[model samples]
Each structure stands twice: as structure tokens, then as C-alpha cells.
Target: MLIKSVFIILLVGLFCQTSYAKDNCPTRKPVICYWASWAVYRPGQGAHKIENIDPSYCTHIIYTFAGIDMDGKLTSLDNHNDIVNGGYKKIVALKESNPCLKVMLAIGGWNEGSEKYSLLAETEESRKKFAEDVSRLMINYGFDGFDVDWEYPTQRGGIPADKENFVALLRALKERLKPRNRILSIAVSASVAVSKQAYDIEAICREIDFVSLMGYDMQATNATSIHSPLKLESSDPDDRETLDQIVYYYKSQGCPTQKIILGVPAYGRSFTLQNPQNNHVGAAVLGVGREGTFTREAGFLGYNEICDLKRTRSDWRNEYLERNAAVYGSINKLWVSYDDPKTIVAKAQYVLEENLGGMMIWSIDTDDFKGRCGQSAYPLLQAINKGLGNQLPSSFSHVDF
Candidate 1:
């Protein structure tokens, strides 16, 4: 009778665990998805509204960009969309569907620059005031917390003191958020060159809930290269720019495994080939590729647009780079290096292998959320969830950084 009871208890526990895994598709890893507010302006099928978001797909959905006012207070950059239209309340309402969802807001993007943030962090009084103001916004708007996206604190017209001061600012913000149990995260550059100059990783990690590492954009060159390669080849000149290198760098610098959130792009980086025949990885480029029909960005192509190209264009062809674990598609003189489901799966597997926090998509809006690709709505995002739920073999090992 004792043995039978023990057996029954074990079976019940196993059944419950299996049920939890199936019900929670993404398992324990958080899928942090950034929702760019401007994506609503994207024409036709590309236009993604706050309602389009499926809160179940993401653990945390951050509203991109609230900015610092000249007076050093938190302010909305888009009053019409963010405030007048009740964007904040609508986004927070997503928690109604998935109570586990953390709706966060980001302040400072590439356009927001670093000068004002540097100034805002120079004094304790200003930092405290800014934190209080941010806390107020979080409380008022029902945001879980805010993300500090100061693009390279000590670079791009910022004072050198920003490196340490950035830490101070985060500490103050964390203090304000901690009492209320709100989250505090920062989007940081993945490049070793920029990271070393801009951040003291150890110090920053100590104060924040997590670090959103912008692992893409390592392909800033005249030649064609993968924008967000998963792994680095020893022969590659920019090996330090790969996702593996950045993750390793942060880990080496004492960032906890759970505190590092690796980022992946929902868009691809494009280049206009100088010679149509020389369409290889290092092929010379004339300039940025033609803009997408919907995104209308000269050098970038959203995953949705890429799907359109694959479906509509007869000449479109793709080649996989096994070494880097990335893919590139070419049509005539236009060449784009981008991530598809395969790439995302590999990265997700890496996240699991490393026991990292989770995966973050740059902007969820750019993903194919309309099912126009004949696969599924939000195909890339679905792939991320799928990968995160996968169980790799015991023999699987991570590549050397």
C-alpha cells in the first residue's frame, strides 16, 4: 500500500509538470518583444496597432520610446499616439489576457541620442527627480516599469562621465521602482568596442532587472555581411561583433545568466550590390537597398516584406551561411542578410544551452503578423516560442566565443 501511494504521487507530479509545459508554450524563458509605437503608421497590412499584439506570445512587451524633456523630466515623444489615443492604457490592458505579461516602456532610442541623458545623470538631484518622474509615469500609465535605451552613454556627442553616471542613474531608477516591485531594464549595445567605452557591465547588472543586448547591427560596413549572426567564424574579421562574443563578454564581466536577454532583429539589413554578379557575403555595395513597399526604409526590410519578396519575386533566391548560422536573400542587385526561423531556433537553442534569461525581438511590429506568408501570423515570433520550448540532446554543446 505504501509503495502504491508513492507511485501515484510521482505520476501526478509528472502529469502536472507536463501539463504546465504544454499550457505555457514558451516554458520558463521570457520572450521580451518590443512594440514600436510608429509601426501603426506603416501602410496597409504592415500597420500594427496595440490591439494586434498577442500578449501570450511575449512575457514582456515594451512600448518603444518615451524621451527626456529639456527640463530633465520624463515626457512622451508622441503625444498623439501615446497619450491622446490612450495607447498606454490599451497596452497595459493586455495583462488582462495574460496576467504574467509585463508591459514596459522604453525611454531613449537611437534618435533620442545621449546628450540630454548624460546631462540628466550628472547630478544626484536630477537623477532622483528623473526616477521619481519615471515612477510617476509608470504608476499613472499602468506600465510595469521602463527601459533605459540610452544609445551608447559615452559616445555620439555624450560626455565621458556618462559611463559611471549611467550606472548612477539606473541605481536611482531601481530604487524608485523597487518599492513598487516594478521592473528596470536597459537596452545596451552588443559591440565590444561600444560596450567597453559606454558601460560598466558589472555595475549596471547589479542595479537592473535585466539587460536587453542589441545583438544585431554588427554589420555596419560598406560590404555585405549578416546583420545578426548567431555564431562567429575565426576567419571573420568582425568576430567580436557576433552574438556569442557579446554574450561571452557580458558573462565574463560578471553578468548573471538570468539577467542577460539576447536580442534578435525582426528586420534585415540590406545592401545595393555594386556588381550584380559578385553577390557574395563580402560583395561591394553601392549603398543601401531600395526601400520596402510597406516599411519604406531604404536599407531595411522587415520579415513581412521579406516574405512578400519570397512569395512575389521569381528571381529571389536565398543562401544559408552554416558557419555563421544566418541566411541572405538576393534579387537582382539588392542583397539582404537576415534571420529566418532556422536562425532564430539556433539562437534560442544557444540561449537554453547558456542558461540565459531569454530572447528579445527588436520590434515585434516588423514580424509577419498577418499570415500573408501562408505559414502563420507572427511566424518569426512563433519560431522563437517553438525554439524556446525545444529540448536539445545531451551531447549538444555551445560553440567557442
Candidate 2:
């Protein structure tokens, strides 16, 4: 109960400090960048301009690992060898180019899923082993820290006991890695219940350096009719990004205010439902993604795809609801939810207004700057930095067109 009381006190302090901040820096906001090494090094992908990344726009570069190939057993330390040697090379190069940029390793992706995590979290030895592997991996690589992105803690396919086990895992991680002083983070769902169930916010904040709120994917594919935007509209059902409410929940639970990172999707999803004409279609059979270039079960599209769609009348964009920004095209009947430079700007502004730790893109690769889409991720970052950062107007003059 005392822990609960302390949590309330922290919440009170959070509100008082945020709403009345005199400094320009958002005291409670997070500054972040999502970097997927594999995606970045694809043929004619992020590599063409990997060196062109602007560090001023972001404070941290989160490196994602897709795991080792099926050949030899992969040690946690060198599991993601391919991405590092090939794709992440450019990432490391960027760091060499910009000393201020910080890189952290993200484990387990949507495809990789969290099937094995339940087994890993079932016992103390497994949890410790996992943490050791993560710590060793970060040190072995040039990474600054680790972000545990186990999709679900208890719901869906996740293990039922992982709710409390997650906190225990983090506690062990904090104790072990404290000496090394590595950055610790977790990719948690936006759901209030899930966050509450998975980890102790206050305890996690104490151990991990920051918490990246995986804010995207709030939309559901359930049969019920729904109009969920990646960035929910103010009018949507209990879905608006109301700062006071969100912060209240976190602070009340003892989560630290300074280490919160808001997650935003750089790209959108085009959902192919059973009916094309129905605006209230449910579920995503396939993705008529950005620019109609690809379709998978809720697969992602790059910023380039969106840009191309804008020009080519991509089916995904053809029937998008102008008001809700929902995509409703394709004869198969599709509805998509994604973010562009414009929407990205709105969320970035929200970060500033709310004094959140800062924002992190779902991935750096999704932000295509080659004009594939109408806009690029770089400009979006620039907008965020300009909006929330201490950027001066004179700095823009030095940037090459």
C-alpha cells in the first residue's frame, strides 16, 4: 500500500511539473528513433541515404535484430549477425558520423513474435539466462542498451503468468546490468491494462532508462465496426491521446515521468476485409499497403509507398476516408490505418504539449525519403525536432536540399 501511496505522490509531482514548465524542453517527454537494421539495408532501401540521417532530429536510434539464420546455433550475443554486418553497418557509420546519436537493440519483432518468451519467462533460471544474453549482446555489439519487445505479456499467445514475471525479469535485469549502466527499455502495448499487468511502472522506470510506449496498433481487427486511426482522433471512442489521463495512470502506478517515450507508426496499414464498399469493414485479410506495392496479413508499408500511392492512385489511398483518414479501396474491400508526415507532425506536437519523454518511430526504414510517398521520414523528423527541439532557424540554411 505504501508503494501505491508513493505512486500517487509521483503523479501529483508529474502534473505540477509538466503543466507549468518554464523551460522549452518537455520535461516528461521522450526523444526517440526506431531503427530496423534489416529493413535499412535492403536492396535500394535505407542504405542509399543511410549516411544522410540527421542526428539533430532524434536523440536515440533503436536498432532491431531479426535473429540468426537457421544454420548454426545463435548465441544471444551474436544472434543477429547478418543485420549487424550488412544493414547495421550503415547504422554504425551514422553513429561514427554523429557522436550524439545513441543506439539500442530491440529483440523480438511482430514476425518473430513472442512464442518462445513464455517458456523463457516461466522460471528464474530462464529469465536470468535471457537477461544475461541480452546484456552480453549489447556489450558485445556497439549498442548502448536493450529494449525487450515481447509483444504480449499475458493476452493473445503470451504466457498467462508473464504479467508478474515481467516485473521480476526487469528487476533481475536492473540489478545485473546496473553495474554496466546500459540503457534498459521495453516495447509495451498502449493498452492501460496490459502495461499495468506486465511490468511495475515505477520499478521499471527505476531500472530501465526509458519506457517506449508502443502507441500504434491501438486499432483492432475485431468483427465489431470501428474507426481506429493510428493516432486516434479526439472524437474517437475513448481513444484520444489525452495527456492528463495517460500520465495520471502511469504516475498513479509509480512509473517515472522522465523516461516515457511515445511510439508512432511511420507507415500505415491498408486492411482488405470481406466487403470493399462497406466503410465500416472489419479485419484485415490483406494489406493493399502504401502505393499498392505489397499485400500481406497486416504487413507494413514504407513512407515511399504512401508517396507513390499519392501519385499512382494506389488502391489503398483511393478510397481512404478523408475525414477519419481510413483507407477503403481494393475490390476485396480494404480499410487501412497508417501515418504520414502530416499526422506524424500532429503527434509530435502532442508530445511537446504533454511534455512526454519524446517520440520514437516504429522503425527508421519505414520513413522513405526518396520521394516514394508524397513526403519522407526525414522531413517528419525535422518537423518534430523543430517543433519540440531547441533548433534555431539558422541551422536549416546549412542543410543541402
Candidate 3:
């Protein structure tokens, strides 16, 4: 009896140690951030470049974008200037600052539409040629991988054949990239309608390294509601979107938890409230919100401008909705909904609880790149990193990538 009791005690100790190790392990998932090349030309609000980026913030950076040429080949979108002026080389050089940082070229954005991709994926010949071109581009540009940003597969001016053709394109690219050990990833929509009608989740999971889920933009210009709620609030309608629902939908469709990256926005959706007194979640809106100082967009505000507004405007008051795990502010008729550091931390906690791969920011340029927000530079990113246990070293600048 004495020997048996000792054996049981040892077993319990072993179990506790194993549990602690599993709980405290470093995050093995990738925190991906997208960097827009065109932001360099956006005057005051959009003057961001590869050099402005903090190498420690993200595990992977995707340069957006390289367009599809007339002959279905990968081509530089910036008037061919990015290629000639060594912009691609500058992006690749970032690895010198953070060797663990993987750089990828993202092809096709919303502006590129689905027409070109539909045609490119229609035939085996086109898919093969496109894959070869992408592989060649990666080799020449020193990119670690490529990400496909197809807006939608079966819909969005695409044919029914796109469902299978999309898979074929991924397969072709994977096969071509396998020898070089390069990664292949894709950006997917989080809309329930598109999610159900579009992606072949299981097949895609089988072919790609990871899926960057565009989980924001749930609320469009036409509606005034929470843009990216962690969960639906009481005031939210039945059809209202939430990040939890988006994540679950993908997981249920057979996407592995570790292969999914939750995308967060570094911007906000603004709405011009019809009645200043009725400033609430489902208030009536009068068209888009007023244009922002830097973004110069009617319904959008970057984190920098948003923080500036909260700081300067007397009417602006921050409101944290606990149930929804979202933050928003109102100043009379002007209301802006965005994720603050606290909300980001909560979402990052959600990422860990769900055992997700990691979080992805839409465009790091939209972040408080100048560190004027007072919570340290990249406050939103810092919260995420801390929540995921991937904190940046206090003296990270000492080491080159």
C-alpha cells in the first residue's frame, strides 16, 4: 500500500508539470502584418515605408501587392517602379533586422477584382504558368512566400467552375513552391454569405501554410453598428457579425485551428449619426462619416487619427462595451467604432483560448507608426504581442534581423 501511494503521488506530480509546460509554452503561431506599397504616396496620412516598420511587431509581413499582367503573369503594380527601384529588395532586406520575419508578396486586392483571377484559374495551362511565374518572382525577389487575395471564388463575377479552379491554382502553386520550400497562403473573406458560398475550406487547408481571415469590415458604409465585435451585443441584430462566429465558421468547415490567422484592423468605421442625441450602436446614419484629416476617406479613420481625435476633441468620449469586447467613441453626430488596446488584448486572449495560429493586422501603416498615442508605439500591436506571449524585447533594436 505504501509503494502504491508513492507511485500515485509521482504520477500526479508528472501530470502537473506537463500541464504547466503546455500552458506556458511560447506561441508557435505566426503574427502576420500586411504592408501596402501605395501608402508611401498617401501624402501626410499615408507616408509609410519598409524602413518605418518595426521588425519585431510581426512574424510575417506581406507586401501588397503585385498585379496580374495581361498575359496572366505576376507583374509590378506600381508602374513597374517597385521592381526597377529595388523596392522589393528593400522589403527582403528587412529580414536582416528580424531573421524570423517571413516576407511574402500578396497578389490581388479588392481593387484588382475577381475577373483576372477567374480567368487565370479557369484552365490548367493558366494555373501552371501563373504558378511558375510566382515561383520565379519569389526566387528573383527573395520573398519567403506568396499570398493569394482572391476576393471570392464562386461569386463576385466568377463562374461556378471557380470553386474547383481555385483549388487547382493553389495545388499548382504548392507543387511549384514545394521544391524551393517556399510558403503559400491565402486571404479569405469572413462574411457568412461569402464564407458559405465561396471557399472549399478542407481542400484549402490541405494546400496552404495558413489562411489570413479578413475578419473586419463586417459593417459597411450603409450601416451604423459595431465593425468587428468579439461577440454580439444585446443591441446587435440577429444577423449582426462577430469575430467569434467567423472563427467558428471556418473551424467547423474543417480549417485546422493552428492554420487560421485572425485578422484585426488598425482603423475604424465612422458613421454620421442622424441624431446627435441618439448616439448608440444601432442609431440611424446619414451617409458616411466626415472625411478624416490624414486618411482623407469619408468613412474611415486610421489608429493615429483616431487617437488624435480622442485626445484633441472635447466632445469625443471613449466607450468600452464589455459584452461585445469592442470600443467606440462619439462626438455629437460623429461616431467612430474601433478596437482600442484593451479590446485588442481581449481579442488576443480569445486567440489563445481558441488555440488559433495568431492575429494579422490589415496594414501596419495604419498603426500609430509615429508613437504619438502615448501608450508606446504600436500600442495595439503591443497589447496583442503581450497577450500572445510574443512580447518584443525591450532592447530588440540592438539586434539586426
Model 1: per-residue Cα lDDT over 273-372, one tens digit each? 9999999888999998999988898999999999899999999999988767789999899999888888888888899999999999988898988889
Give the Å error, residue 127, model 2.
3.5
Clashes of 1: 0
- Which clashing pairs does model 3 show? 96-401, 97-401, 98-401
Per-residue alpha-carbon lDDT of candidate 2 for residues 1-401, written as tens digits (9 for 90 to 100): 99999999998887666444323332323458876554533554434335556654566777665432222112333334445444445555555544445677677666655556665667787767667776676676667777777777775577668777777877777766777877778777677766766666776677677787776665554531222243334445664433334555776787766677767666655555555555454543443333334212243555555555556663443443333433433333545555555556666666666667777777655566554544444655655565565452223222211
User: What's the lDDT of the predicted structure labeled candidate 2?
Assistant: 0.58
Positional deviation of residue 208's Cα in model 2 after best superposition, in angstroms: 1.3
Query: Against the hidden reference, what TM-scores do the models get?
Result: 0.90, 0.72, 0.90
How much does candidate 2 score in TM-score?
Answer: 0.72
- The candidate with the higher lDDT, 1 or 2, is 1
Better of 2 and 3 by TM-score: 3
lDDT of 3 by residue, 1-401 (tens): 99999999998988776566435533445789899888777677457877899877888999998889657888888855487667899998887766567899999999888888999999999999999999999998899999999998887799888988899999999999989989999999878778777788889989999998897878756657778888888777788778888899889989899999988889999999899888877778997788877778898988888998877888788888876778888898888888878888888889999999999988788888888867578888787788787856443333321
Q: Model 2 off-target regions past 4 Å?
A: 1-30, 40-54, 66-90, 222-235, 238-248, 273-299, 314-335, 372-377, 390-401
What C-alpha lDDT, on a 0 to 100 scale, does residue 193 get in candidate 2? Answer: 63
Candidate 2 all-Cα RMSD: 11.7
Pull out the clashing pairs in model 1. Answer: none
